[model samples]
Target chain A: MPHLPPLLAKPVDIAPLWLVERVARMIFSCVLKAHPDLFARLGDYRESRYCFSPSDLQLHFRVVPATQALSVSRGTPPPADAHIEGPIALLLGLLEGRCDADALFFSRDLSVSGDMEAMLALRNTLDDSAIDLPRVIGSFGGPFSPVVTGFARYIRTRVLEGRETAWN
Target chain B: MELICPAGTPAAFREALEAGADAVYCGFRDETNARNFPGLNFSREELRQSIALARRKNVQTFVALNTFMRAGDEALWYSAADDAVALGADALILADFGLMAYVAERYPQQRLHVSVQASASNPDAIRFLVETFNAKRVVLPRVLTVQDIARLTSQIDCEVEIFVFGGLCVMAEGRCSLSSYATGKSPNMNGVCSPASHVRYREEGGSLVSELGAYTINRFGSGEASGYPTLCKGRFDVAGAEGYTFEDPVSLDVIDEIDALRAAGVSALKIEGRQRGRAYVAEVVSVLKKALGATSAERAPLVSRLRTLSEGQRTTSGAYDKRWR
Candidate 1:
């Protein structure tokens, strides 16, 4: 229930889409590097595209699992085989496999469209990966590892305030 | 009645325990268990750790080896049973008669539970299993009405357990081949039904369509809540009526009938959804535990809190009411 930061609270379309897309791609690459087998377990759905829409930010992030590609956009939202819309925090909570996707979905805190089966495929794959975002981000740095990891953990704590994590 | 809960992973298992679960049931991360979904279930190491933890908390652990045995897969089922007993599982929930016989003969002192997959609806079948294998408990199939459950509980000699919440299988438990016919996999054989591997969803003309294997399962308009594509909950044409012939997409929630269930001699109330996450398990277990502690007049609202967690955001007592012919 925490209000988003002033910068992110602004209409996402007003931001430079290229810059955001570039930063998002870098993070996605880091995640894939940390867990190389992340999407391999998706089976057939690994060939599918998944769209993550942040209802609060009005932004869409379409990820192509086969190619390990991510694109950021607004308006029409890229065509994908599976799509989920929620607060940006909840979406990132899913990124680290911290929040339970089924719980949020059942509560109507989020909406999923397109291929539910494919989405489930993605969910199961993500759940087992045990991806910890703070560790993944911190591993990339030598001198600044502590600072970056600490900052990342702080952000995660704020983002997931009033929410239950995987540890319950 | 004791509250039994499902846990697909170690995390979910802990959540259930923390939420006041009397017993936590889980399966190995393989086809030996009915909920053999990918990225879920326990490793031998995980189950060992879970059992160690459960012992400290004095909570029982039930390991499900409920799937039917296949010709070449007998060893897997046998090995799973050995490991579960070795890890000190409080009980082994078994369905296959062959496996049951093997376990009964080999581990004579180990407690055995007749899995619902056995579909022992009648007293004769229940008594046969109890006499044959010395089964301690029988999880009644979800097809029976509350009245039938009460009558059967009275007639049977073993302890009775019934499904109180989560997914409802319209077909007779353990005997249906609908999922196999559609997806070439079944809960009894492969531990999956309408598996994600063979399922597809697409939007056509503003309606979302769900398909399993090659057949259409269900369709939802713009605002209608979508549902799991289990074949039993699908829409199909039957006798000139193109509608949901089997069941609507609603989870079975009979928590409000807990007092009645206790009166009928149900030893445990089982919650389904081994495929669900920790949050769902924690919430449902906590809510049910609270409802059990509440007075009869205070129980309905506790059950109402579970509405959001139910499938399709709706709830049903299912066959418990016996409202339909």
Candidate 2:
């Protein structure tokens, strides 16, 4: 392996897994609210457990979607129906269509395992339902919403700049 | 000129055909093709069906057996070519010299195309493939200017295809080893570069960092758009200057250069996203189809729309414009 810069050798925590899950649940809930048919389009796999593992963060989330409700918990479920694992930046890019899902998967930057149909459905649904994380988080006008949005923006900027600078 | 598009799956194949693609190119679900992503590509049955569908619509189906063959795994690539031919592929796009020779000898009647993965940029290299393998067309690598293409077209005997849109590889095709150096997988042999299995992202000091293998490709700031962590597109510090040292994380959009390409005696316009989804295939093909027939005045808005679909919201003509060199 090539030498990584000394500044990037150590992992830093901008937010904990629990905080990320909590914010993810809130953001997904808002996404569901805006696009009511989003989860419905998931068909029979609406209740399936999906695992998202951010390799660098050493964190994983088991996401479950019930009718009109979405839950994200830290760590994997006992038996996940599908797993989408990648860098958090690429995962977020998948949501916003900023990153090419195929490019990530082709370059081996993203991996999907288990339920192929469910994964495809999830991918198509995400592609169809436009998701803007900052906009959604910022829309939650409450005492803590600004803090959430600020943190989200901070993370977004760092990841994006990292991605942009890494190559171009 | 023909509009050749990429289709990673059956649905995307159908989408491209429906969206006015003159031909659709794809690969089998394995490492035989360059865009070897998991959960993508077509199975044998799917390819058969897709070809039938394309035939029904009067659109050609080209099978990409473009990945280089390992010495011991020669049969695998030969089998891929046999299967592609048996499945009624209109043409076989190939890269390996041995595989090309094998296909040329085995299926003498099958139409053969030189893949961009061959990196036959100059007239001499391209002429060698055309004369040796009887390749009918050659997909030019994204390293030549429109003028360079025009010059090569005048010198080469076979048809020339150039990438018009989608992801851009900064390095020369078939020669880049950055991904293999960072990750064990080789795009030539394994049909993947910067494989997803080797990528990781971490947050350090409020900055988000993307790593491919053990190398830190880039670090991002707050609210910035993140691009994919391909080795070629990553930002790096060269002599203390922090920026993309090789190339930017930008997509190649040559919609505005259609006339230049057409004038250059180009045979076809190729879209580069086979690993993309059906919606992307439909959207991009639909726009390019319109652009093909629209006037310059009518194309400005369409070009802007394409920019929205580019990587990191950025697009370039790449080496198509001489200024980039």
Candidate 3:
């Protein structure tokens, strides 16, 4: 997965932090509703605090599975049990289990710190759950499901375009 | 030769079978098998369902009860063997001598394949397993050259299985204690080598320092590809020169040596990584399946793609040719 253009982040960069944080919370709620057992496979690490910091964006999201809460901030987030930093596209690809985390890490495209086991457990759990972001986002749109799904898919395609998920 | 693939999950098993695996090997989610990582492996019900699907597709299913049993805990491994057999596994891939003996006496008709953990390289070792437990096949350790394999095949009575792709551990398989010395966990006992729980990566002086417990395994400069600190593949300062002293961080891929392996009388080719995702399983299975059926020249590009999938985007023929000393 490639990094997004600065132009794509222009509008979001200008948007107020509260508005962005609210939107992130709403999306997180939608994801949780779609995959109730998402953190079930995490087992002992279910309580670990996970931080996702997208290098291309100003936003950082933190999640503590024990609380089932997603909080977003403009600057550095609080201390986490595990934290992963990468391009927003790569982060999304990993969320959808479309990108190979090991491959991405091996190639130095992503950087992770803190508990490796907790992060690996999360990765495996996510991969097995088969999270479809477009579908999940669309499911919340009611009558506008198809249009929402199409737009999400189109954006995802553009982000992942020419990047074969195969290898290298 | 049969194409045997590994499946840690049902989704991986389905992908392997769908990608044209002749046999798919999996393990129960416990200490009974190797690659016993969190959020991985199959439950009893999952194994039962997977075996049924493989049988319907006419593909063999091998259950890996490959870990050694601990004292007073033999019952756990023993029960796993019974459950795997009861689920109609085409073969039980086992490494424990006591468990193998138990299976031999109780389920005489069930087929047994010596796991790589057994490290049965010599004719005598192979003969011992085959003679005592009637093991139909033996998965050779990753320390044999093609010539060594050919010679062993010429002398042994049972079929030979060799690792053709995936994670490479260059130690004397199942006998190494480096992981335990660092993490107090070894694959033979706990089904993990350099267990992730003890692994940590830290930024130090513009380099990424990967450590296994208190021991620093390797340091990677900016933008350099890196792999897990599996001790065997870690870099260390030896004779005042720092480099990969044991083995480099690379995966084992012998796609180019298919003809040589075949001529060496390998009865089955195995792709490792039971802990990998289904996409990895699917890609490796499909490409290798094509290579097995294609001419040598047609295998070139496929081999190239496989290297990209290898750990750290680097690969080796490993001990297959004995080129590295």
Candidate 4:
């Protein structure tokens, strides 16, 4: 197996799964609150916003760090401002800056629902931010390399286990 | 009374027909069909030719258009239905409700057989399909026992086709997302499960590790035989347990149970594995055709002869006996 980068090594149990997801959401909300220009391209003056949907076992965060966000589920789709719905691997690929939003959208991995401009704003915002998972691990005094590596390992393990997504 | 066999390709179709299959079931080469492998299934022209050939042999051809339709891409499925009807298919096997509705509404003259992908386990669901869409036959999922099959036959108006031999899916059909979760492609969405596109085999430290996508599904030493990587049958570790957690690698061989199945009112005996070669089709078909005629006492010896050809050299009655559950 190849080595996983430090960014993906964070352990799931560092906090509750819900808290970990909520923390990621809070980070995005704070980033949007601090820098409105970051999201300007993603939204218009009338439709500047962020959308988040947390299922019982999965958390989805689509933010317009600059303008608009859209969300969709299996049967229901939210208004398309910034759209993203995917298994954890694809979602992680988008959030970790490892994948381009355009590739995911074109490949039909992550679907878009609302205004393309607003969706782009949210995608760009999420793509540009450096979430600094290692720093978060260090503050908690956990093994940074091992955690990120473990998370990546878990992804690889569960993928083999035939679990598909990172949700229940 | 009909022996419907699966044909992954034209060669398999020929093999099944020559082996005395009364009817052969196959799919198109595209995503409209379920066995969406590279060299498997018939093209439109090939299907047209195969239908004519089967007709000469007095064997019917059923086209499997079993995949679920995506939100924006109902056109592909719609066109497939039109093509199947135009090409003179004996029947159209379908699972999707919207697509079933489309076929029912668009080509009412064409016969409809319900694919096991719908997971319609109950009599009510079967009756609904029969009453609403006029399904002529239904391939029941492997989750039901012989008693269940008998009960279902007593209740439903349509004919039932039971899988008698070939690969056994331990998981309930259409309900599993293990393949889609590992690889982005899915049987429900893309008409394939554990597709070869994402499979990788590597020799490491004198042992072979088989991977699906990026995850290792199986590892075997030089002495061990490697099996195909199906999620439900794959060995895994969960809660400090390691081994075949769901099901051991095996095939479903009910060669000896043909009499029981006949007694239970099974209209057709199906052999799975459209991905298999023509030789496999011929061998399995010949054995099954003979077994279909043999008495219960005579079948034991024939079933024993078929043991070596079975996957992993082991077979299960597989939900036919409720104790296996």
Candidate 5:
């Protein structure tokens, strides 16, 4: 058979990249809104301390590029208040509610470092964001892509049903 | 025949020792140990004093340096292992093969017990530890049935330690990535699972929703008991129906099965709450020590009493019966 043009050689797999960046932006927006002071100074640093605007809030977070995260930190650092490590997919997993933070912690899939104060701040901030499910899906452009929208709906429904793990 | 208990802090360690525990296990206040909770576990000085105190009572002390070693950062784990040995730890409960290799090579004289984080579920996995690292004991994961334990004990060369009480982890030990996937702190990495730091309780539609990180794991009505917001026991919605698909909120009460476990060749029975207060530890341990001699039928009432002390006032035999799933 004659070769098709490179553009049409294969249907683009924009799902992974699109999915990750979209969710990253959501997490970004939530964190920015949660701590505007920290976001204003985020700059391009590889590591940061995200001290909340008020309360006794403080956390040290390290942002490793997706590829380098595995090699940079093997496990959560007790000194780090929060961590954004792992491939972009893993972070996306959290934002999309496809992952459980408790399981991740047990499996060392997402490592954290630091004291409980930092831990408490990060947890409280993330809880307040509620960026998963309908909110995440609604934020995306275009009429809800059936595939993405379906996944979001499924997650929400399952979460409501008390079956947290996707595998189950 | 030792009763190994966890101690999240120096006070907890002293508490465990005073509570008739034959031995207490603790970790440094870092990733080196599995119970890496804040305001918990021991500092180096505290560990030293704790060990000395336990030694005075002829009680053994073990240090858990259980988490995996990051590439190029094996030194920290190694140093922790070495320090544990230096501080006169009776045994070092280890998980990582690389760390085990280091300890075997450097501190060959020091005893090594495999941490439950290794999740050696079968004879082959247990054999690997025995042959490779010469581990003296293996803390079996909580997923095994009593029959499974019998089969495993018949094949493995090492002593077997199993969880008898306290928090129930439904997932396969050391394998599930649920917690870190949510809030970025994990048991394997940070030594905590479904950590309290990440838990939030909010009132919604006249119900109390318990959230861990960004996910609502459970919701309770006025008459219902609210369980600790651990990810595994958290009730969630699946396929548009709500129920606990993972595990019910309950404490493991193997008190009734102690005789069966003993007959199956279990070498040790572990109580899970190192973060618990001295009063709770003393009460539970004292009761269990007494139950160790009682018949299984007689132990049933104690199990009921333990349920009253559980987070949601529920109790389970865990994987012992094999029908819970």
Candidate 6:
């Protein structure tokens, strides 16, 4: 697990489910614009609903694709075409191709249910692109872009160093 | 010491030979090889071409029929052995006792190297494999410390091959059943661990999540890089403490201990990662080739270069350093 700055960690741990959901919706809205090709490929999932759950934070989101926008809900929206669950870091890793999907799944770090073809398509698409979350998020910060980038770099460094210390 | 490397494709096989690998190991594109990932491995025709290429360069070619044979599917593995010999491979790397027996009896003139999947760590076990299957060399499992390996080397009759670098498996190679329990596919039986068809990733509540089958193996905080989730390397909550319960997500790297390993009577140094691409194989083989020839002072920089390619951006001496115990 990645180590969070104590100040940020506490608030996040205590944050309400609704707030978390709202933030996810906003970030994903920007993400879809940044990678239109990725969302376009998800056209096969047009009528499908997918559920994503982060177990540690006890948060979940139901996602559906519309013609131009994605509809996301905080609580159980409906029966999903596929369900994916794990930790926040791994989900991001899959998007960025920083983590190997097969390796994580083999270790039982991540899981998926229903619609195997949809899942494979998503995986292959992500693997083909370089989706850096920090850069994507920072792209929207305008004047604060440098600050956002710096903070993201710092947090990433801290997490990597902590993991190295623990493992080595 | 001989430097052995892995080649998943015919292109990688040629790359390894050109990059100074003393020998290159590869397998057919089937369940017969441990790295049975899609789009990887060679067909029989490809292997024949690869062997011919290695012959011209005077480099050895070893075929790995390392996965264990299922009871009803022995013919598939048996045919792999027969074809590898027919293709004039320099040696055969085998893991199963029955397959070993079959190869030993039919092809007495062929050389055999015991695969690491056999998990033969001790001298007695190594000796048994040598006597029973006529294994000329044994690839030691990654569980032994340097001193333990040195001790075993002194007693064993055959040559010993040690993994010098690449991905680390915390569990005993052939004995691990964690994948089978969750995925219904065993590396020993199906030649894959954590098959990709079962992996899924999702975004929830501002956090990204990764899962395998029905299990939530790990969670990462925002901005943290996630690692491949092998069961042993995943973090878990044990007794209110949340951390890695078995092993951490780190690759094995023992370049710093080359002198010690050489002194310990290791005859060959193996580099893992057949599932990796030709570029990875080429870069690693080139650097390690220089390191193998360099003096102690010259090796430090070369070792650092290889670290950038490690699995988790972190490297460990693994069991070579007893502190890990």
Residue B208's C-alpha lDDT in candidate 6? 47
Cα-based lDDT at residue B8, candidate 4: 72
Judge candidate 4 at residue A159 and give its lDDT: 36
The CA lDDT at B50 in model 5 is 89
Evaluated with TM-score, which candidate comes out highest?
A: 3
Candidate 6 segments whose C-alpha is farther than 4 A from its true place: A1-168, B205-207
lDDT of 2 at B265: 98
How close to the true structure is residue B297 of candidate 4, measured as C-alpha lDDT? 88
Candidate with better lDDT, 5 vs 6: 6
Query: What would the per-residue lDDT of candidate 4 be over residues B1-325, giving only the tens digit for each residue?
Result: 6788888756568778898999999998778876776545677987998999999999999999999988898999999899999999999999998999998998888999999888888999999999899898999999888888988898888899988888787666777898999999888888888886676655578565667887888776654545566777777888888888777767888777777788889999988877655545666788778888888888778767444445555678888876833
Estimate TM-scores for all models: 0.84, 0.72, 0.95, 0.65, 0.66, 0.68
For candidate 2, lDDT tens digit of each residue in B124-214? 9999998999999999999999999999999999999999999898678988898999998878888988776676765567565778888
Q: Which sections of candidate 3 miss by over 4 Å?
A: A162-164
Question: Candidates sorted by lDDT, descending order?
Answer: 3, 1, 2, 6, 4, 5
Better of 1 and 6 by DockQ: 1
Top lDDT prediction, candidate number: 3
Selected candidate, larger DockQ, 4 vs 6: 6
Q: Write model 1 residue lDDT over B1-325, tens digit each, in one string.
A: 8999999877678888999999999999789988977767888998999999988999999999999999986999999999999999999999999999999999999999999999999999999999999999999998888889889988989999999999888778899899999988999899898887777766688676878889999887766766778888989988898888789878898887888888888999999988887767878888888888999889888788666667777888988886855
Give the poorly placed runs of model 5, Cα more than 4 Å off. A1-168
- Going through the candidates in order, their DockQ values are 0.31, 0.06, 0.49, 0.01, 0.02, 0.05
Between prediction 3 and prediction 6, which has the larger TM-score?
Answer: 3
Best by DockQ: 3
Task: State how far residue B102 of model 6 sits from its true place (Å).
Answer: 0.3
Per-residue lDDT tens digits for candidate 3, residues B108-172, read 99999999998888999999999999999999999999999999999989999999999998887
**Which of candidates 3 and 5 is the stronger one according to DockQ?**
3
